[model samples]
Target: MDEELYLIKDAGVSPRQVRLARVIVGLLVLSAVIATPLATTPLLPIPGYMSAFGIAMIVVNIILASLLFAKGLIESKESSIRLGAAYFFVTVIFVPLIAAFPGGLMEAPIIGSNSSAVWLWCSWHTGFGLLIIRYATSSDDTAGTATSVRKSILATIAVVALLTLGATLGLPYLPEVFRNGRNFFDDSTILVPALVFGVNAIGLLCVMRMREEKPERLWVMVGMVAACIDVWLTLYGGARFSLGWYFAKITSLFTSLVVLISQLYGITRLYHGIAGANKILMTQANQDGLTALSNRRCFDQVLEIEWNRARRDKRSLALLMIDVDHFKKYNDCYGHLAGDDCLRQIAQQLLRVINRPGDVAARYGGEEFVVILPNTDAAGARLVAERLLLNLSAASIPHADNQPLGQVTLSIGVSATVPGPGASTSALALAADKALYEAKESGRNKVCTAPRELVTPAPPAFLMS
Candidate 1:
């Protein structure tokens, strides 16, 4: 079971995502080093220039987070991928409020500011810890199960919103832990940091023990562990306005940087990879391997589309079923290698004849070909089948065992119909097929036409031997 888990993990991890994630992590560390020191500028304590840079970072982080989350939710989303979004969410929502408030990062540490600041601060780290644990222990991205990561994330959001409302509004109804808690920058609450640290420690353990040893996961574990230490320093390292506070702020910023950047990078790779696969699949489905023409599947799809269009628009649709005369005897005489060459030549001739727009020529099967022509009538269909015969006759390939001049030839059956309700399209195909059988029976090399009603006799004009 463990080996199976490891194999899934290894296959799921993308090296491109990991490489890009490393670049983001380095940038994040730099951002933390720069943003935290700027927080202590000797400017007014308003949400002005001092908080401007932090605000910008918060906004950018939010956008990136939303993209990661949307990608994870709609497509094949992974749990760790969602964690990156969760970090950005916490940063954008709570950090801005706390940092913008007076006596927080935006202002000098007031000894007794609003107690609500403490709860908001606690909420950010607590949310962060919970997201980490959720990510680390969640099922692998490749794991097929009844589990839904998006549903779980949404549920987590609802629960957090409820808890926050109770702690903020219903505080009067609860005890000391709920109401009037001291701000971290004011009286410095020890309980907030302790509880959050405890939460993140469990997260750290989960990340370490996850089946996938993706480097991005290790970076998350690093951020979690650093944040816990940062919280501890803020609580027990003495005064609120000391060096410990600065270090804590720096560490906290670094933590967000690590998780958010890596996630964005990884999600970007996943998006492009999925897109490439879809493109390849579409090509394989619609294209033929041998003659490089439309395959049977593509032919059927085009026929249906044209059939519906002709039905509505009252336009004529023509079909031609062309078969190589004496193809099997030719194969028996020269072997399959020459048979393949002969088919390629025939396919090229058909393509040359059906060059107009809305005309589709496809390989129906061995030595049998089909052409769909929209806005073409019975006369036009007959002309196309004649042109096809002339094109092959001009090729002048040797088929000695074939009768007459001992050269290659084609037997074509043309059918045309103006499609409408109760007028079966399958009947048109059957008529063309019947016409082909007639062409084959009357003589091996000729063009036969089957209109909406009766099958017309084959015309003996430009027949090549």
Candidate 2:
């Protein structure tokens, strides 16, 4: 469920989605079956019906086109861009188609002669079919950068605009599709619808062939099938206001809405998928792989934040820099896996000791760890360090390489300070490190406190041992 289904252009359809697609197609087929019998039966035309239907078609397709355009840019897929362009083409063509619908726009045909409506209808369906074919055949590979995709989309828009204009102005001069109010089946202009039917059938086949390649294309395929049926109904009805004509308009609406709903659902799922992935990535980046504690990077960030807060509040801040005794020797004797487990166990003990919400324990580096304690003085930090050591001793993890009393042990250095104006946080870390070196030099299992002067001290050599 967390998988980014939206990003996957060719993700296979699940069985559940397949069954749902079948149900939708079945309903479309059933509607076609009923409409077939009433194809030529004339019905009373409702005022504004075509205008309303045209507006709804425009709204649905434009929204769907925008969503696909966004998806194409996000995923860098050319197919989505091409598909979006196709929907946009249909949306633009609908404007002229509606305007030319006899008496629909202005009580007289708005843009062209009475026969202009049929010509525009043929032009729209043919152009839409060709665009669908283009989309269905587009490659799934990442086509280009976002910039290039945007350029392509703009170019396609320009081309669609010019095509729409050409069809509107040029097609009206061509031979009439049908006489003013003649039945299309009884006229020579019947060839227009027949040709459109063939083009749509080809588009449906192209989309059907893509079904296995891109599972989400199931919706597109369904839409294409409905489009073919719509045209067939228009052709069979042969005249305006026939039952098939109205049913054809209804089917057209169904075609666009189905794809629009699917896109909305996909985008919603993608948002959740990205959010879940980001949360996991953040956890991985901040936490140590081996010890499951905050890593050095997180420690550094938290130290700076807490240091600034301490300066503002004038409260004491403490740090404990802890190093496991003879850890290299332990790894040499017991292997690296045991060394890793030992670190994890030590981290668990630190977590147990530093119970306050403001305390942070993190792996500083190899065999070295640090704890930041807010509002705590030197005494509190030392007490917490001693508890960590006691907890590890109780675990009794054998380290034969460690001399007498030979279980794993730690050398801890404690430093505490109340920040003053213009003070650097690095001084606290340096002081803790100096104390840790001193603890190791004095003896392996011990604690040492840094002096208040916070001066650099001589380097200790016991690390190589």
Candidate 3:
């Protein structure tokens, strides 16, 4: 999961900003859904001539157009954002004049390019074509792109301003298209909207092909479909006051909704995925794969922790370094696969026997395991080693090649100490390791201890059992 979008940290949008944006988007969608049907429905007891659907459409369309512009400006990197901006331009600048007068001709300074419904349709498809280009090409450096976005915004405002000025000045332009009590397919209406929907569909397909992340792609795809539906209704769905026009408004609501829902869902999945990956990484770090015991890293950490505790309490700490007897020979005879299984069995037995709160059992290295017994004396350490041997023998794992009485056995070296100011964990570990070597030298499958004297070379082979 990416932090980029999930928490909005990468995008740099604050939570308060997102919430406010959402509220505005929500209001725009809800208004779109209700405005047309409420003003145009025939089920109401209002006179057909008094239908206010056209007025409602203009208001809702302008509001939706502004939202799209705001969204595109904020998300300047996305081509889909440009599509939103294009929608705003078409609705606020073009839709009103065309809806109000589809047949009114202009003959003055600047021509009304969108004076006809057919011309408006052409401009709509052109906007979507630009969107497709944006989606295919990744944007510039974010800082650079934001600058570009600001310039684009100023330009759009100017363009919008110019068109309004022209309309107000009665510049030369073609009349508009479609009206109540007017035939939908009459004079280029049917063909124009069909072409617009076709262009939108092609742009949508291009978007899906270029992107692989589904969450990011879903909203745009849905918006394109809604756009197609809106075009379809404009072409074949009776007149302005018909049910089709109302449904077209509903599709308008759908366009905004898809963006909100997909973004939120994408964020949720990211959080869960990151959490799951963290858990797996933690397990792999601390646990031994072959034996399922704490790995050497975990042993090192626990030993350091317990060593400090012993030094603080002025209590004795014991370490048992246990090695499987003739483990090389065991692997050679049984194969490495069986050797791994043998280690798992041995580790499981050790875990069951060493169940004290202060005891920590870990796989220290190949064929060598260790247990830290905090607050334990040599006597208690010996008892644990003995019990471990008994339990392992009781399990009766086979090892018929060598040893004094071996059916797979452990040689354990016990080291116990009361730590002082000069004490260190490495010194304790070295003492335990030497004790293990002595136990192996004396005879395999024996328990031995480091003697009180730090005389190094086994101190005459220490003690044995």
lDDT of each: 0.68, 0.82, 0.64
**On a 0 to 100 scale, what is the lDDT of residue 285 in model 3?**
93
* Native-to-model Cα distance after best TM-score fit, residue 389 in candidate 2, in Å: 0.9
Estimate the TM-score of every prediction: 0.61, 0.82, 0.56
Q: Which stretches of candidate 2 lie over 4 Å from their true place?
A: 1-10, 35-52, 66-81, 102-105, 137-188, 237-243, 451-465
Which one wins by lDDT: 1 or 2? 2
**Which stretches in model 1 have alpha-carbon errors above 4 Å?**
1-215, 218-272, 286-289, 420-422, 455-465
Q: What lDDT score is found at residue 80 in candidate 3?
A: 38
**Clash total of candidate 1:** 0
Model 1 per-residue lDDT tens digits across residues 1-465: 334333323435467655765675565456445545443333322334325435654765566466555555554657645564466656444543444245446364322234444555566677777877877777755432224444544665675566556555655663343223322432344455667779878887888798876656766766776677566555543333445455565666666666566656565555556666666668778877778778899999999999999989998888998888898999999999999988888889888988788899999999999999999998899998998888788889899988886998888888988886456667778889988999999986788888567432343456532
Estimate the TM-score for candidate 2.
Answer: 0.82
lDDT of 3 by residue, 133-179 (tens): 46545442332245545555566566656545545444344334434
Tens digits of lDDT, candidate 2, 92-194: 7788778878767777878766666776677778878888898888787857356755675577567656655655577645665555547764456566677
| Residue 461 Cα positional deviation in candidate 3, in Å, after optimal superposition | 30
Candidate 2 clashes between residue pairs 3 or more apart in a chain or in different chains: none
Q: Return the lDDT, model 3, position 85.
A: 52
Candidates ranked by lDDT = 2, 1, 3
What's the lDDT for residue 227 in model 3?
63
